[model samples]
Target chain A: MKRIAYPAAIQALIGELKRLPGIGPRSAERIALWMLQSRDARPLEVSRVIREVQESIHACPRCGFFTTDTLCEICADTTRDAAQICVVEQPTDILPLERTGVFLGRYHALGGRISPLDHVGPEELRIDALIERIKAEAPSEIILALGSDVEGEATANYLATLLRELPVTVTRLAQGLPAGGGLEQADELTLSRALAGRTAVKG
Target chain B: MKRIAYPAAIQALIGELKRLPGIGPRSAERIALWMLQSRDARPLEVSRVIREVQESIHACPRCGFFTTDTLCEICADTTRDAAQICVVEQPTDILPLERTGVFLGRYHALGGRISPLDHVGPEELRIDALIERIKAEAPSEIILALGSDVEGEATANYLATLLRELPVTVTRLAQGLPAGGGLEQADELTLSRALAGRTAVKG
Candidate 1:
């Protein structure tokens, strides 16, 4: 005779839970039990939130940051400087910059860096969209917040070349951030240092 | 204008992917993309495995090991001895024991130990059912494979008293496991020590 009773639905959740990183088969079982016990708390709520985020989420038309509306809040804000835009590889990279209260403008998400080994090239990133934005918006400066990785540098170099056609300043976050550090992980001091020491890319 | 386009249906899956342990929002995105890309690989087939497991999964009636049918294969195996039942706090503990392959019989998942701090008591566990099983089957010995932690000791003590009323012998896995060592994380050597040195509870 089976001891504990669980319906098929719960098991499905547990199996899916196991597929996540750091969660082993055992940990998945614990989480499944916890979520079920707190069923009133409704883990489905987490999934619901996921669905909500997925349904309403979209990238900012001007910059690549995530948003619920057509344009990310940063890009929609007219009060922010129209002449400057920060460029990062991902939306999560914007958090530290927002916390710094330093840059008051817009952002551009490259989707990812260019890694030829990974078959990701300039065509794969938002380089063309960024070029289109520069031409349309005519920003005075583009601050590159890309990572210090080989891929990030290549992407930055690719961006610099593309934007050379525009009559705008092209710059990179200074050398303060440790090489290979993701922007999301960089400390406030490091981010401030990088932001302060930003160098204008020579065309 | 947003640069990239992904199907809305695919984005929903990504959001669900992020809710798992160690999966950050970005990793969630990547997983979602990968899963979507592999949709032709019978994604639902995987989910079907999950669903089938969820729908059909049942723990062993006698021991708490996971199973699909009435009794876990180990519990139902007519070849294994029914005269002995190794006891543990959680289902995961069965793994190391299984790895040792020293004892040949069945297992009993007590659900967890008695930790008053966590409001866990014998009442919350399957201890009562275990007593019933011990009485009904008249096992030759009851080997407790609980951790060497304070809670595990307390649980072993409690079960010893309960099993004392019976005609069978009650033993505990030795304290060869270091203090605070969990059965789940114990090395094979440590686990083997405790397993080999199992002693009869005097009380």
Candidate 2:
């Protein structure tokens, strides 16, 4: 007997859905079916919104953050502290730091960290742009907010060396146990980092 | 401090993405970001495919399956056995049964089962069309290949009662330990059903 196959349009839609970050074959099929069969216009709304975003949004030239104009919101805002610039690997990383409400400074997205295995070097990142920004804007501090992984460390170290000749103080985010995380869940590296970075009690 | 929020377009896109089945806030944000930042034209392709599917695909008028034409492929095919009509809850359910390579008959999708709690009645489903088909085509057997859940059982029993006076025989898929499933994993209800429906040895 000849095998039954999904129509070409449906198969194509499923293939597209599977390219999403976490969606697999079964999830793609389910999503495709839902989009086709759902009573509401949500799927169409998604398509419209995607087009709207694509047409309007672009990366900020100065900071590498998503923007609709000449500069991103952070870069454009006059009230944000220009003396301190927090650096991160990607634009997505800025949101969490903003949510914390601790950092009132502006941000600079590096696009990605330097990874030798992935063939990404300093030249591939926004390092030159960052150096230019430091020279022009004269921020007192450059806080490295990259991850604690090997690539993150290498990138931070490399940035610190590059910025050494400049008049800015380079700092990195402390490596330690996460807030609300229990000691029992801490790995050996995390425990050692916590111990090494311990601060004196205020009392 | 003023709270930082995503731009209006990005937020709208995230909201739309979250409406998809199984996608939550984080997943929606990730997908929205990926769509905005991906180097390839995949996101635009998805938008185009969605529009294409919406414009072309419609439920088959006769069988309620997805089709771009007058009737679904299964319904259009003349070689399929007209004597046996398999009934399913949704059009999506037919694919798995088709993949099993056992059933070669035409299918009737009920669209959904009779669920009083959800206010879905027989009138809301394709029961009338099924009965009409039975009277017009006079198939030999009607197989209820629905899930073994409460709603499925209620629907199957209701259909059997409704079709009692008809010339066709009513049957359902067997309830037992699944193929490749161990007896130890079988629940009490499944075990009881397996025992009650045991077939005689062929030796």
What lDDT does the true structure give each of the candidates? 0.73, 0.91
Docking quality of model 2: it rates as medium
Clashes of each: 5, 0
DockQ of 2: 0.64
Q: List the pairs of residues colliding in candidate 2.
A: none
True contacts kept of 2: 0.61
Interface RMSD for model 2 amounts to 1.3
lDDT of 2: 0.91
Q: lDDT score, residue A95, model 1?
A: 59
Which pairs of residues collide in model 1? A8-B54, A8-B55, A11-B54, A61-B1, B64-B109
- Which lDDT tens digits does candidate 2 get at residues B1-203? 47777888899999988888888898989999898779788888988898788878899988888899999999999999999999999998989989999999999999999999999999999999999999998999999988899999999999999999999999999999999999999999999999999999999
C-alpha lDDT (0 to 100) for residue A111 of candidate 1: 81
- How much of the real interface does each model capture, measured as fnat? 0.01, 0.61
- Model 2, range A16-108, lDDT digits (tens) per residue? 999998888988898999988887787788778888888899988988888888998888888999999999999889889999999999889
Which 10-residue span in candidate 2 chain A carries the lowest summed lDDT? A39-48
Error of 1 at B109 (Å): 1.9
Model 1: C-alpha RMSD to truth? 8.3
